[model samples]
Target: MSNGNETAKGMGRRRGPMGGRGMTPGEKPKDLKGAIGKLASYIRHFKFAIVIVAVFAACSTVFSVIGPKILGKATTALSEGLMAKIRGTGGIDFTYIGKILLFVLGLYLLSALFSFVQGWIMTGVTQKICYQLRKEISEKINRMPMKYFESRTYGEVLSRITNDVDTLGQGLNQSITTIITSVATLIGVFIMMLSISPLMTLIALVILPVSAGLISFVVKKSQKYFKNQQEYLGHINGQVEEIYGGHLVIKAFNREQDTIEEFDATNQKLYESAWKSQFLSGMMQPIMMFVGNLGYAAVALSGGLLAIRGTITIGDIQAFIQYVKSFTQPIQQIAQVINQVQSMAAASERVFEFLNEEEEDQSVENPCDISKVTGAVSFEHVHFGYQPDQTIIHDFSVNVAPGQKIAIVGPTGAGKTTMVKLLMRFYDVNSGAICLDGHDVRSFNRRDLREAFGMVLQDTWLFQGTIMENIRYGRLDATDEEVIAAAKAAHADHFIRTLPGGYQMELNEDASNVSQGQKQLLTIARAILADNKILILDEATSSVDTRTEVAIQKAMDHLMKGRTSFVIAHRLSTIRDADMILVMKDGDIVEQGRHEELLKKQGFYANLYNSQFEETVA
Candidate 1:
């Protein structure tokens, strides 16, 4: 089991919802314009749909803006008829007022219909873009080099798929429509206010700078708190996930108190930042409402003076007051949309950065045919390093003929697993060549080259599926009879049958439902079913009891009768019958011979073999 600190280190940084908190300081894009440019290019294919959405949004805002002005005409006519009735000239004109009310209602209904159509189209477009981005990211994963994944955490890669994509989708859907409608409303309302009275229009305009200044002050004050809040939220989530995953290890080590104290520290920081940020964000609405009331007062006072001067009617005053309210709303919406754009740009940058990473060349000009490969392999003066400056395997050379059982014995970090990785072409040698049947391994396509060998590693891997399905993964077309036979040969059939569902037993994620030795047996059975020309077993029997190890050794012998086999083992007793034993130390072969011959030589191999017995006897 891993410790909590190691688990947290492996997880790296976690991210929350971008739309909820807006753009935190650390989450800002390095190059905002560049990221937006790339995003525009990516969505260029959907230009026609976007244009339609824009037209509909504009039409919706225009109709809504006109309704207030048209309804003001009804008010003016009603006011005139009341005065005329008092003078005995005319009563209220109910017929004319009803026509104006119906017309205004129709305009509002049209505005709602346009808003719905635009919303529907924008939603479809956003989903399509998200689908395409996910598809590309999935394909990119297959072509990325092994070193890229080895150097980064799984959570880091998964975030690009889940959190970043979700942010981009939600931001895109909201930002475009909000910008269009807000701008249209601002322009239309300003024109209507000016038509009523330029003096009142000027008064409403003066209050804008004051409202904008206060809003700016609130935003600046809240930004630092929001950044801190988001940062601690990520830390808190990572700590929780790490602690939960390694709970067993924590219990074994009796570190529960220490773990609780650490969590409390992080939780306290989160509480402090969260409440401060929320308090500041919550202040915006009340501030805007207060400023808006002042604007309403000024506009009403000016309109009253203009009515007394006989320059504007009662209906114009009403329409001008409504326009003042409408004007301030769009300004607030525009400010909010600016924050959403910043969040969207940051998410788009992350996604495009991943998509633009260097991809491994999965194809060659002329691939070698692997139809008749006979399992012969060689490493000629192979020199390699995970990093160029730090060479691990130096001047290594080896040769194996067809149908040979080669045992590689070594201590830990003796370049034992590194050799297997080189043979499989997971990483290429720096200064030499690995060959298959006299042809360079690089000459064959990666897929075809991998298909010729079967491997069972020390760590067994099983997905979430039935036992039969997991076994069938080795050879997709194998029949049930063949699978069962392979399991019997691997000594896994007996244990598998004892389970409640037998071969049909469902394994959860990680396959922790089975014992370690049983998991090892299942992997061995999978290798047997593959029936490849070459086999690589890295500590294949390390997890089993001595009796079970002996049984597996016998079965492995039968399986390797006429196939080229490479076995890596720390247990010296298990490989006595190997045709050749190559002892390695510090990335070089130190001794080679049959087991008895090496023991008789009383060299490094002899000392290693004798010490195991000495330790067991003590």
Candidate 2:
């Protein structure tokens, strides 16, 4: 992570767990119950199927719970029949024993069949839930305003879609089944044990509180670590994503060692929390088993004494012992299920938080059709800022006549791009309104408002595709001939034709196969193909060499002939021929004039223009 105080503050600002900020998600959101309720809303669509699954699950657990008791009957019959044969004239009742064994087998098979059906239905239910969640999240991403994404890392956002949703789905599936089955089994086993012998049941129940206490202790201790594990995992993911994306920068600046150390620190933190949570949660089974053994011993001793006193039959004693053993499993499962639910809740909170972010205010009460809008645009006394207390653009105003070439020039943080963003309504002005052809920009549907203007930004974004396809992105319905013509207009056709496959040549990811200048040319071609009445060129020629820049400038001149154009440039020379120049400083226009007039005034624009010449002379 960078040590800049602003960056540090951003990383430390609390949002929630997986918030890409600090450690926790502030507070637990109503704990497990709240998460379960939210998840239930998604699950309600499959209620009929879930209900059937619950029915089958209950039936299966009932069968399983009784199987051991029935098998004990067979054991008793065999032992009694053998004793009869050894004692005197009678032989074993083989037929009766066979019948008991067959009944036990049938019960087990039915249990297995019902369990399979339950699982089969649950698989579909869980997958559909995940599908719906992911679909909604995908749509939500599109509707989310720029501010939401700006506040978080890309990895954090992606993790909500991938990791958090998966966790919710998987946890819901297991927790639902486990809760139903475990509770049913625990109830059935307890009833069977009490029927066999209340004394033995009481003896077995002795371990319940101790086991519960142990489980509660482990869960409470482990949950904090689990939460920490999740936070650290997100931190590590964010760090890794940032580092990998800037691998080139790291190498160039020879900051590889610093990057690695930072990654290792975050990785080490993740490892600690991950293992600690795992180790604590993992101890549950053994501790429960030990308590189970103690219960088993108590049951054995009490049942033996009862059998010797002829108070209970051998078969009943055998069934009671099996119940004692089976009883602990469900309790253990229930404990683990609780843990699973807690983890699920943590994940659900993050996922739901993202889904509920404030979307773009897209309401246009009286929408205007922008299809035939004139190219004239005006900003009147605009006051805006990304945050409430820190206004960046104040009392800003501008008016451009149709077909005028207006150049905005200023220092780096002079609200240049902010002005462009306001013009496009990427961010609405806090007070004033931007108008297009005498209509407030916000009065038009956002999509309609954006269609009248085409933009080529400083960053040249070309996805992995054929050169022709990339250019055609501006107007997806454009024909190949139109694409080629647009390329020619941008002075990109000559170089593109020189490639092995001409226009069909495939660009790699990041478009690293072409030089930065060529990438800029392709973007220009895209804008040309768009053929909108208004155009924005934000340092459109910055990447190209002087020769290419001159050619591109000529092409842009032709493109902007009858269109309203806004050119934001740091290189003062390029905008010298603009129809009007608006010189800005600290969000306000300090000077607005033609090139010759601004030079004669000897104001900020003159000094800014002369600085370039002085630097070249030096």
Best by TM-score: 2
Q: Which stretches of candidate 1 lie over 4 Å from their true place?
A: 1-28, 206-244, 255-294
Which stretch of 10 consecutive residues in model 1 shows the poorest summed lDDT? 1-10
lDDT of 1 by residue, 466-578 (tens): 98888888888999999999999988899999998999999998789998788877877887888888888778788789877876776677678788899999988888988
Number of the top lDDT candidate: 2
What is residue 25's positional error in candidate 2, in angstroms?
Answer: 9.6
lDDT (CA) for every model shown? 0.80, 0.82
lDDT of 2 by residue, 1-618 (tens): 001111122222333222356554323343556666778898888999989998999999888888878877887887788888899868778888889889888988999999999998998899898898899999887666667766776667777777788877888889999998988888999999887888889889999999989988998788776666666666777766676766787788888888788778778877887788788878988999999999999889989999999898888888888888789989889888877776777778777777877887666787998887878899899999999999998899888999999999999889987887788776788998899999988898866777788877666678789999898888889999999999999888999999889999999978899988888788778888888889888788877799889877877887788999999998889988899999989989989999999999999999999998799789
lDDT of 2 at 470: 90
Tell me model 1's lDDT, rounded to 2 decimals.
0.80
